[model samples]
Target: MNRKAFTLIELIFVILLIGVLSAVAVPKFIGMRDNAKITSELSTAASVQTALEACHGEWVINDAPFVCGNGIRSDSADFNATTGYPVTLGSGDDTPLDKILKNGATVHWKKSGENYYGPASDPQNGTSRCIEGKPCIGKCWRYDSAEGTLKLQTSGC
Candidate 1:
């Protein structure tokens, strides 16, 4: 007798191999995706920082006028008097920072005192080491208006 078919034992072995491979590969893929999101968020934050610096440069070149656009020297509504950076990102198409940061479509920004916080690309539950043990859903990027610094909270992401 001649046969050309996989036996039940052979099929079972194939299935087990596939399962093992999937188990090992899936977590790595997920980790990579999370890492990518973190990188993207950090890049966006850096862009915002650069824009802030440019605005300040212009402000300095123009003699640091107290009142410029809309009676506000800074680009956004949440202008920080100390660092010359927007404490809170503005909404609307006309807002300067909105145009610079792409209208918060990718990152939602809010201000608390002189600090600005934005949502991370991915929402995960963890504590960010950078934010005084603050619990973050996704990742959180904190911008310090006084020091002109940006901090990334990647524990959640």
Candidate 2:
């Protein structure tokens, strides 16, 4: 009888090769994942901006006041408050960015929740800080009104 099977040496070599490949591919995969997170954050920011603009137009025309966050929410109207740009919004729930980027990412807020932005979420502990040099990403977006941008930067995963 003839049996076809991998020899012990061949199996060992295959395992070593796999180990090597994994060692090389793991970091690259992690980096790609981080980049995907950043992309998602950018898209979310764009939506928030669009919502703010739309809310602003309506508020201006109807003379109404409301807040714009992840979603459009309004109570009644703030008769005492001035008519201006709506506040920014966030996921409200803690996000995957928090766990995955605990070391190399952060979220920032520019003026207020009204213009929050930054590295998708907060860094782990001492890895990074907002452009303002503050530790953010708990429940806000780092804001940069001067440049009119909300960035979510990461340290290459």
Candidate 3:
């Protein structure tokens, strides 16, 4: 008689194969996700860098300080007279990044798409290391205004 259903051995073999495939694929999937996150983080960093350079360019061209913002609106912000970068004050505040980024349209630097972006956990030291034990304000993509750096962290999982 033609078998209408999978035998016990066939079912077990299929289950094992699926299990093995998943075991291999799960780690790869996780790695891909981490890579994507790293890429996205780099992209965001580049955007902020471009914005900062534009501000600096304006300053260089004008030979004077420009108004990044009035600091009244979330979209508006303050910039440093010497650096021409946004006035972050290095207090773990997202205002500078947000304002420099024109933080309208859900560009909340504090939290961006399952990832948090803001100042380093330790501003005093100004040397933020998120994966080395301490996380930036509880697991975040740290933006160091002083050093003008964005720390990207990926997982081994």
Candidate 4:
């Protein structure tokens, strides 16, 4: 005969156990935030396809002759003496695909026309050829810089 409160069936069983634990933790936190954004867009398309096959195998070990666009090895890095890759899948900064996968091609990408890609709703008619992927729930990771590809489209999530 001395208790003072909480007995409306223990406040409706603690508000029905906090609405059943927020309805089972909000769809498992929105399915773990869409599986951590498709595992960070599949680890940024496998580190920009291993830095576009190590800058096209260092432009076929530099014997591919002349103009690596910026890099030979000391890492100014931009490749493409006619298909060593990265004349533009744009990683920004100075472009030409971030001069060797800098920032791992920055996930959920963007930049549309000049051809830095991923997550562009539409603006890409400038053409560098091979920009088809449009779907990581935000899409755009299919960059084929002269056959040094990087794919992770995931069909619109």
Candidate 3 error regions (>4 Å): 63-98, 104-157
Q: What is the lDDT, from 0 to 100, of the residue 53 in candidate 2? A: 58
TM-score for each predicted model, relative to the true structure: 0.57, 0.44, 0.50, 0.37
Question: Candidate 3 clashing pairs?
Answer: 69-77
**Whole-model lDDT values for every prediction:** 0.58, 0.45, 0.49, 0.53
Residues forming the 10-long window of minimal summed lDDT in candidate 3: 69-78
lDDT, candidate 3, 1-157, per-residue tens: 7778888999999999999999999998766654554445456667766765665566666754345432322123444455455545222333434455555233434634222365323334222333453333234455444444556443310
* C-alpha lDDT (0 to 100) for residue 101 of candidate 2: 25
Q: Model 3: how far is 153 from its true place, Å?
A: 11
- Candidate 1 residue-wise lDDT, 14-79, digit = tens: 999999999999999877654555555566667777866765566666544544322344644556
Residue range 29-143, candidate 2, lDDT tens digits: 8666555554555556666556545655665666444544333444433111344343323333333123112221234323332444344453453222233422234434543
Query: Candidate 4, after superposition: displacement of residue 72 in Å?
Result: 18
Residue pairs clashing in model 1 are: none
lDDT, model 1:
0.58
Off by over 4 Å in 2: 59-84, 87-120, 123-157
TM-score for predicted model 2 compared with the true structure = 0.44
Output the better candidate (2/4) by lDDT: 4
